[model samples]
Target: MLSIIYYFVFNIFIGDYIKYSCIVPADASFQVYRDNFIFFVKVFYYFRYFLFCFIIVIRLFYVKNKFFRWLIKKICYFA
Candidate 1:
């Protein structure tokens, strides 16, 4: 969870930088910028989902502690 928050915060800053650097001229419409932003957001969403599933599988199969298993269940309840 900490890593996910960090990853998103880092990407948000990077995305802002990219948008600032890639701004179009005053004569141009902002559709291209909008499309690029959407694309990046979708990519990030899919990547995060994949990472979450991978972590869940790893924890379920590899971790052996009864307390840890209970913690996972509690986490899932919140999720």
Candidate 2:
């Protein structure tokens, strides 16, 4: 169940990345960039961007929730 959730999160992030990356670049270079790689390579290249997004989500969640902060503190204190 947790893995499924993570997969959905990653899928959403990757979809957004491809959507914005393709639309945001106006130059021929972007086409060249896309053409230079095969499909799997492109997905592999975007994995780091996904990790970056995951970190940002975690950071934002951590900042927004007092419960999460307290939970982390207790875990650390107990550990």
Q: List candidate 2 stretches off by more than 4 Å.
A: 36-79
Question: Native-vs-model 2 lDDT?
Answer: 0.64
Tens-place lDDT per residue, model 2, 1-79, is 8557666766666566555665646577777766544364557557757876766656756686888877766765897
- In candidate 1, which residue ranges exceed 4 Å CA deviation? 1-28, 65-79
lDDT of 1 by residue, 1-79 (tens): 8777757664676566555644544334776766677677667656756877876767685678878778777886898
TM-scores of all models?
A: 0.43, 0.31
Q: For model 1, which pairs clash?
A: none
Least accurate stretch of 10 residues (summed lDDT) in model 1? 19-28
Candidate 2, residue 75: the lDDT equals: 66
Clash pairs (backbone) in predicted model 2: none
Please estimate how well model 1 matches the true structure, expressed as its whole-model Cα lDDT: 0.67
Q: Which candidate is the best by lDDT?
A: 1
Lowest summed lDDT window (length 10), candidate 2: 36-45
